[model samples]
Target chain A: MIGIIAMRDLRSLFAQPLAWVVLAVVQGLVAWFFFSGVGRFERLQPQLSRMSDPPGITDITVIPTLDSAAIVLLMIVPILAMRLIAEERRAETIRLMYSAPVSMSEIALGKFFGLAGFLLIVVALTAVMPLSLLLGTSLDLGRLAAGLIGLTLLLAAFGSAGLFFSTLTRSPIVAGVATFGLLLFLWVINFGGVDLGPLQPAIDYLSMLDHYNAFLEGTIGTEHAIYFALVTLGFLTLSVQRLDAHRLQT
Target chain B: MEERSTLIEADGLQRFFGPTQAVQDFSFQLERGEILGFLGVNGAGKTTTMEMLTGNLAPSGGRIELNGCDLLDNPRPAKASVGYLPETLPLYTTMTVDAYLRFCARLNRVPKADLDEAVATAMRRCGLEDVAERVIANLSRGYKQRVGLAQAIVHDPEVLILDEPTKGLDPIQVREIRQLIRELGKSHSVILSSHVLPEVEAICTRVQIIHEGRLVLAEDVSALRARMQHSSLLLGGRALPAPESVQGIQGVERVERLDDGRLRVFHDTQSDTAEQIVARAASEGWGLWELTPERKSLEQVFVDLTGASESEVQDTNEEMAA
Candidate 1:
């Protein structure tokens, strides 16, 4: 049933004119970011190589693809996930879904996979820029792969959070806004403008940006992997519970 | 241990939105092969009851059983048997009608082998072939409604629960849907809730009326008509004798003169013996006006059943427990 639902959802994604436009915009931005970030890094590499032990100022070729991908993800993903349940509820189609034999878990998982599948395709297409980098510059294979892994994991986390917000209301716009708001808060809360005393350790560990930090250095951290996986599972479980709660209200 | 004839039952079913009880202690039973019509005003618990029966909503209290399976205890079994169409027909606007129906079939776990035939049959049954490939967003409301009906019946569950199935449609479309429902009733036990009195009178075998979350009355079509007991038989013949003579027959409760001067006889009877009535009139050499067994109208019964007339209160009380 999940496969069946996901198939329909994926088809819907490709069928829409708006989706095509979003896809084009993402490609254009990702390509620009890749070239611009790498070009700047290569120009600085000559003077940087003369210096000993450059921390964050060294060549950014490896991290640029991951950084730009995260930016594309954070922007493009909610639009995809916003329509998952909220649009159905708004259009009164969720009632049909509710009456079907499929469980809420299957529906949530189906939407996740459906939206994730789109992101996967987009992520795959963006990899051509990084692959081209191998022809011109020395690239660390392990670090590059780890960065891609971190970006995919982060996308899953965002997708799950977006799905949870979708279940909060019947309005897709509200879902989109609220999910983006939550993501913004998550990003900003750790660095400044918030109390960081008792929650400092937990907050830092759980931060979506923090989890992707190791990927910038081209190293896969088990801690990052575990944290991201837990975030995805937590949001999905919350989404399913919200659906069950709404079903009871009907 | 009694062999239950009730195909579906709700006991003390209740739902509350904050302090307002949407449905309260609402209980009723649907017998096998019976088309149960639930009548109500807006917010009168009709859809709420249907939802609870179909396992779409959980009741606040009491138990519901369908085919002797507890609806509350095991919703899966009951829900599996239910084919529900809610007031707002849920549809995916992007998919074509055929694709949407197939998706519904897949969700219901229709076997891979059965998918094509099932989709085709549902389309054929619901008259959906002409626009099968058209996107649902482009379709007309009536056709969209047909798609809604198609999705519900495509899986062919045991019980069909329709809420306002003919809600917004032309007169002809309403007739078609009613006919479709009546045809479905031949196989499946159907429970449809409608505020339309005449439609209920025309199609349903039995009706359960609810007012403000409580049951008012339930009765079989013929029995409900019998409550009035005023038979309207039109006998065209040579006008003759006194109207009082026919009124004197056994089981003849009352007689009223029509505009044509043909008398209408109200009778509570074990059997309508109009033949015996005619025979006695013939032997008396009286010019018998009209003497035919009249079929009482269900409309009159509906009015009396729900009306506030003082004289009807006693009969209403007696028929309320059906």
Candidate 2:
């Protein structure tokens, strides 16, 4: 059932122009970031060769481009996920999901996987820009792989949270705004006042930036993986619960 | 323990939103090969009751059994046996008719091997084969309605629930949809809710009138007509007998003359007074152009059963007609 619904959602997503527009804009921005980083690295390479320890192209051009792709995805993914459930509810097609033999969990997870699949395609298209630098430079393949993993997990987390808010309302605009607000809050919560003693670590743990920063440096720690995994599961479960409650509350 | 032949049995179904009692004590039993028409005024909780039966809304208190399976306790099998077309047709406007039906078929757990055949059959049944490749958003309202019905029955459920299936349709489209529904009723137990009394009288085998969130009356259509059998004859002609002369006939209860050169003769309910009136008129050479027995329309029965006054019923019926 999840596979079936996921395929349907993906099909519907492509049927509309929003997905194509978002893809075009994100790729344009990613390509721009990649070329600028390459130009900066080219200028800095002559001076850095005299130093004892010189940063390679991966550290200067590829990592920053990957990081920029993550930032671009964070802003655009809510738009992709907004229509997953909210548009269905608004258009009254959500009743088909409610009355079908499939469970609420399957519906929620199907939508989550569907948007995640689209985001993965976007991530892969963006990765081609960084991977193309291998023609003239020795790129750190391991770090690039880690960053891709981290970005995909983060996209899944964002997709799940966006889906939760979508289930909460019938307006896709409201769902998009609410999801963007939640993701922004999670991203900036750790940058509050520096005087907190006990809550500092907890706030840092909740922040998405801290976990994603570790993958940018090629460190694949279980802690960050667990953080993304737990957050994804939490939002997915809440979405399922919200869907079940919708049947009851309506 | 009883061998239940009832396809759908909803008892004491109640749904309340905050302090408003949307529906209460609504109960009905739908058997196989039955086309039950649920009639109610707007905001009379007809849609709420249907949402409960279709598992879109949970009742505050009720027990619904579908084909011997408890709806609440065992929703999967119960839901699998039912197909629902909501008031606003649930459709993905971007999808083609064939794709949407296939999606609905898979969602309802139709096996992979049977998916194509199921979609084809549903399209053929709903007369949607001609525009199977058209995007749903581009289709006309009638075709959209047919697509809705096709998606609902793609899984071949045993029970089908339609909420105002023919609402907002033109005369010809309404006839087409009603014909499709009647054909579907032959194989599946159908529960249709509508505000149009004539449509109900035309298609439904049984009529269930609901008012103020309660089941006011439930009976076979023929039985309901029989209950309102007020042996009245409408005699129309240029030179009809006087009202008093018609009243003098045996078994005649009362007589009144209409403005349009017609005599309405009320007679004993147990007698064939209409036959006698026709014979008497024929023998008297009163220019009997027409002698038709008047069965109280479902509209009159609906108004009387709903406990609304004649004027209020007229207002709503006029609204419905417009």
Candidate 3:
């Protein structure tokens, strides 16, 4: 049932021009950043050759490019995921799912996976930029894989949050703005708690960018993976609960 | 025997939207091969009751069984047997008609092997085969409604709940859709809601009238037709006796004289008022020319039960007659 709904959602997303526009714009920006990083690496190579130990091309170019890709995803995901449930409600098509035999969890998870699936395509397309460097120089395959994994998990978490916000309203514009606001707050939450000695660690643990950065640095810790998993699962569950409540409130 | 034939049973259903009570103590039983019509004016809880029966909304307190499966306790099997088309047609406008029906089939758990055939059959039944490849957004309103209906029956559910299916259509389109619904009624139990009394009278075997969130009347269409046999007679004649003299007849309760030299007499339902009036006209040299019994249309009955203005009912009756 979940797969059926997910496929339907994914197909509908591509049927619109918004998804294609987002893909083209994001890929254009990523490619520009990738070439700039390569230009900076070439300029520093002669100075690095004189040193006994120096930063490699992966650190100088690839990590920064992937880091920018994460930020780009953060801005564009809400645009893609906002219509998942909110548009259905606005159009009154949500009644179709409600009247069907599917469960609330199936609908919520289906929407989450559908949005994540689209974002995965964006991440995969970004990976090609780094892989192209294999034609000239040796690339750090381990760090590249870790960066891609981090981006995929980050997209999943973002998609779940967007899906939950979408379920809260019948207006797609409102859902998009709310999702973007909440994600921005979570990204900057680490800075807000830096002065509090006792609360700093707990607050820092909630920062999505911190966990994502650890992956970019090639340190794939269990805590980082768990944090992403918890966020993804937590929002998806809340979305299901919200949908179940609709049957009573309506 | 009654239990076996009962396909849908909703008992003591009540729903409250916060402080306002939307529906109260609404109960009805639908038997197999029955097309039940829900008739009500706007804000009469017809849509609310339909939503509850379709399992889209949970009633505050009630029990609903579809095909003998408890809707609240075990919804999947119950919902699987039912198909619903809400007041607003739920269409994924971006998808082609064929694709949307296919998706609905899968959502209803139609097996993969049977998906194509199910979609094809639904399209054919709704007359959507001609425009199956067109995006739903491009279809006309009547065609969009057909697509909505096609999706509802795509999985071949045993029960179909449609809310105002023919709403906002031209006369020709309405006729076509009504014909389609009547054809579907042969194989599936249907619950159709409409404010148009004639539509219900034309299609439903049983009719329910709801007013102010309460069911004011429930009767088989045949029984209701029997009630439509009004106990009033229109008597026209030259040199007729005064209305007061006509009122003195044994079965007559009241009499009103029309400007056209005709008298309308209200009488007891079981009495032979017509025979008595005929006897008086012959013996008294009344020269009776016309004596016809007035048959009340369903519109009059609905208006009388709902307490709507008598003038409005007359206007609609005149329009319908024309």
Better of 1 and 2 by DockQ: 2
Count clashing pairs, candidate 2.
Answer: 0
Model 2, span B208-312: residue lDDT tens: 888889889988888876777766888887678678888878899888888777888888787778778778878888877888778775557767777688888
Model 1 has an lDDT value of 0.79
Off by over 4 Å in 3: A192-194, B1-4, B231-253, B257-268, B271-322
lDDT of 1 by residue, B1-322 (tens): 4645677877778888778898887877787788989976666789888877776676777788876778656655566667888899888888899999998888777888999999999899999999999999999888988999999998877788999899889989999999999998998889999876668878899988777788878888666555646455544345545667777777777767778766666666664656656777688765666556655444344455556465554454344332
C-alpha displacement of B160 in model 1, angstroms? 1.0
Give me the runs in candidate 1 sitting further than 4 Å from their true place. A45-59, A135-138, A193-195, B1-6, B67-69, B228-322
**Candidate numbers, best DockQ first, in rank order:** 2, 3, 1
Judged by DockQ cut-offs, the docking class of candidate 2 is medium
Question: Clashing residue pairs, candidate 1?
Answer: A143-A218
Stretches > 4 Å off in candidate 2: B1-4, B240-242, B279-285
Chain A TM-score for predicted structure 2: 0.97
Candidate 2 chain B weakest ten by summed lDDT: B295-304
For all predicted structures, in order, the TM-scores are 0.83, 0.95, 0.91
Candidate 1 lDDT by residue in tens digits, A130-208: 7776776566667677777888888899999999999999988889998888876676557876777898888877677
- Distance from true position, residue B313, model 1, in Å? 14
How does candidate 2 score on lDDT? 0.88
